[model samples]
Target chain A: MRRVAIVQGEYHVVYQPGVVISTLLGSCVAACLQDPVARVGGMNHFLLGEPGADVPVNPADMQRYGVHAMELLINDLMKRGAQRSRLRGHLYGGANIVAGLGGIGTKNGQFARNFMRTEGIALDHCDLGGTQARKVEFMPYEGRVRATLVQDQPLPPVERPRPAPVAQPTGELELF
Target chain B: MPAASAIKVMVVDDQTSMRAMIRRALQDLGFKDIRDKAGPVEALAAIKADRVHLIISDYNMPDMDGLQFLEAVRQDPVIGKTVFIMLTGSADKEIVQKAAALGVNNYVVKPFAPAALKEKIERVFGELV
Candidate 1:
């Protein structure tokens, strides 16, 4: 029953039986991939789909991008004896969590779905796109996942009262 | 233009490992004056006490996130114009737009290599010789 928690821009692969990988998500995405035949699996958490062409990036930060995160996870799983053809994928997170933050969650979910489809990986389960944050736990060896909604929504910022306006002197004041 | 060795840089993050990593990268880039703070509050105080040329901060932190810190920096007249760079885990457009609105000079994604860090700084201060 060893537990491993990964934050944003990280991934974990496990072949042992008693290991569980976990992460919390808000406007982010996590992908769980496994091969039933090889009994190998892994999970990755990413912040966005792809960097804009203007962004200067390198290999060290690849995991923070969904396109690269998926590739890294699959490569790691294959290295551990998993077959790409036999890989089954489960997707989670991508919750909006907060309003006015844009639809980054929707974009992330779309990216994950498109990636699996383009890669020809079979999608076993998906839980994505809501206003609440989620806690996702994956049993990599078992190829099983559980997602729980942690909060309804983040509380709105408290409104503060504005100060009364100072009265301006009308016209020109006479020298006293 | 000040040389990299002359420019003072501050690295802020809750994780010591992340701060250390950023510091190492800055050092590798030839920066001599480097300071680090574990949270935004301490970082803000330090900046007011003695200003730095650049501030590189992580987006997610315990007391106050990077956005709030950016707002605070922008609101202060004395240090508002200092160069600011945000380190984020995501490249979400919303974050980019927000940071830009807050007057962030530049931003780098997490787990960046030294080369990328150099590029970001160079973009802000021009080529570091």
Candidate 2:
């Protein structure tokens, strides 16, 4: 069984992947975790590196930041019978799509890297930070991920534009 | 024309899936003569060649934009008198005014429910019934 989720805006979710926890990313980031031994895993998407001020969260906003999103994903796996020593992570999305954001994507990537290292989880593999939004399909059962990168701006009506060609750059935008 | 057969619709949008979705919604509402196009150019061709009674178009695209499409539709004598409806999320005053000037009958913004679209279509063409 496969399930898909489109993560955008002020949203946070937690799920145990009996199969997969799939999502897409723009200026956001998602951290995936798997307990190879326990065979338990899940993932999450957060809008920005810093969630900023004024947004109220259910439990607390302090632990809802970017750094904490990763921490939470990891800890969730551990709670599901994952040993900290055997847990592995894969990161996606921190694209420089929005130009002149003061290297916001780069900052997010660094935050994820530091958080992973600091938390003592061995970073098995990572594909992070680029200039494309990605559609990701993760198979927690077999620990496999299929990602699609759609390189086009969402033409929200406010920007009344012209006709367009349907040819899109579809490929493995990145692999890490 | 009677409301039962009063209006034919042309749905224009850049997203293939979204266009299909709008078409499905139109079908569910019993809108006959529902034709969909991905870009304004194709839509313009359809407008020029066909007897479209109404239009529902997405505002943002790469080729001919919604406003230009609407203008082209109005300029074409073949279907100039047909009503227009814009289904989009654009809040631009200039664009809206231009569409209004073109004699568009109605508009539906983005992130809308199917019932909302049905309501607008019903409102604009409701008297036909």
Candidate 3:
């Protein structure tokens, strides 16, 4: 099977069978969308929802935003013969991973959900926010998805002191 | 503006590579006192223990996101006026607005070059010498 790995701000569409799209996500969201009847599908990874009013965004980096990423993925899929009305989505990623960091993952997940709803796309499965990072694999042509949690490093074991040996009564009291 | 060598700056991010990248950028800009922490909680504590002139932080972090960290800094009397610059992967409107509302001095999107980082700092502290 052919495998394609996409990082933040990237999307891939496939109409051929045996093609898998994958990504590792942390505080980012990936949307796997497919049109079963048309046998076409694709995936997109976005870092955030949209650029703020005062924030200056370079044109080259626009696709990193959710708004543009979504549009581009959907449009690309449609261009490959996928129908917008028959679209189905499976959302993944958006894990916080760190305890104190703000909920960027949560916000990303929310944006994906809202976008799907507002665009009238049917969401069949979703595995969003949590404290663990995720690795998502999508079979675009088959419209099949598998999401697994990426394990964090385990804590080191604590060292315990060995018990002191009991002394026999030798009666040898040396004066200091 | 204080000399880059004299001004103490703190770079906070959960990723080690990101912290190193920012540290290297700051070093390239002739910044001497650059300290980094992996998360906002420790960064906040370090600021309270010893004041820094400026803070360059990533928006997505564990144990307190960048906005929360900014709010904590803004609410504190000692470090309330510190110049802050946010580093984010995306220029998401909500994150930007929130950071601005929390009194961020400026922000630089991720995948930025050293020159861009320097420009953002210059915007906050005037020309760096």
Candidate 4:
């Protein structure tokens, strides 16, 4: 079986048999859309929503956003002969691994939910929003989806150097 | 004087939002010399041009993954010894082992709070006082 690794901000669709698509996700979200009747499925990995004032200025960078990734994935699925009405969604990732970094995961998950709702696609399964990263695998031809929680193994402690002392101002004042 | 304010910290992530979030957190933590790059390639270029006291990099990127970038830094004589903290979504033991072998100073999982990031930095470089 041929395996295609989906990197961050990318998506792939498969219609042929014996092909597997997989991705590693952290705060990013991956939406697996499958047309069960047509046996056509695709997956997308996206980092955030549409670009706004704070987004990167490069137009190519916008492809990583949720809106663009989702559109690309959906369009590919339909282009591959999958019917929109038969499409089912499986959402993964959106884990809040960095608890204090704000809620990119939550936001991505919400975007996925809203995207499905707005597109009229049914969500068949979901594993989203937690502290652990996820590894997702999908067999598009079989409509088999598997999501595993990547282990949160603790790193061994290491010795660190003491902080260097800061230079202090001299008490004597000199006029220039 | 606050310790973190003098440190030159660079944040590298493919996602603009992640970079902005980390930059905001660093600013809130009183870090003054904070620079952000979109990915490892740009970050490497920046490091070659000037030195950064500490680096906070996302693990996954299109050009060079964090581990590969870390290894590259370790090999570089000029900026090899700079403190590096990896920001990853995966806590998998294998990745942790690889990072440790590559001499990463610390690892912070994704979606981390500003306080948590500060704590990790303090753990490596002492408190921000």
Instruction: Name the top DockQ candidate.
Output: 1
Show pairs that collide, candidate 4: A97-B110, A98-B110, A98-B111, A98-B112, A99-B111, A99-B112, A100-B112, A100-B113, A101-B112, A101-B113
Task: Judge candidate 4 at residue A6 and give its lDDT.
Answer: 84
In Å, residue A87's CA in model 4 sits off its true spot by 0.8
List clashing residue pairs in candidate 1.
Answer: none
After TM-score superposition, the amount by which residue A55's alpha carbon in candidate 1 deviates from its true location, in angstroms, is: 2.3
Per-residue lDDT of model 3, residues B53-88, tens digit only: 999998866468899999999999999999999876
Residue-level lDDT tens digits of model 3 in A37-137: 99999999888776543354554565677776876687678769887789999999887876675787898899889888877789999999998878889
Give per-residue CA lDDT, model 2, range A1-176, as digits (tens).
Answer: 75656353222223345465677676566777677777776677665554322222322232334644554455446546666668777778777677877777677777667666755667777777788877776776576777778687451111111222233332211111
| Candidate 2 chain A minimal-lDDT segment of 10 residues | A155-164
Query: Which runs of model 1 end up more than 4 angstroms from their true locations?
Result: A152-176, B1-129
Tell me the tens digit of each residue's lDDT in model 4 across B1-129: 348888999898765546766787788778899999987888988998999999998786656889999999999999999999987542344666688888998877543445557767887898896
Candidate 4: how large is its RMSD?
15.8
Q: Answer with 1 or 4, whichever has the higher TM-score.
A: 1
What would the per-residue lDDT of candidate 2 be over residues B1-129, giving only the tens digit for each residue? 256344688888755545655776676666767888878888887777776878898776556778888888788778777778875442455666667877777776553445556657777677334
* Rank order (by DockQ, best first): 1, 3, 4, 2
TM-score list, all predictions:
0.51, 0.44, 0.51, 0.50
Q: Tell me the TM-score of candidate 1's A chain.
A: 0.83
Q: How far is candidate 2 from the true structure (C-alpha RMSD, Å)?
A: 20.1
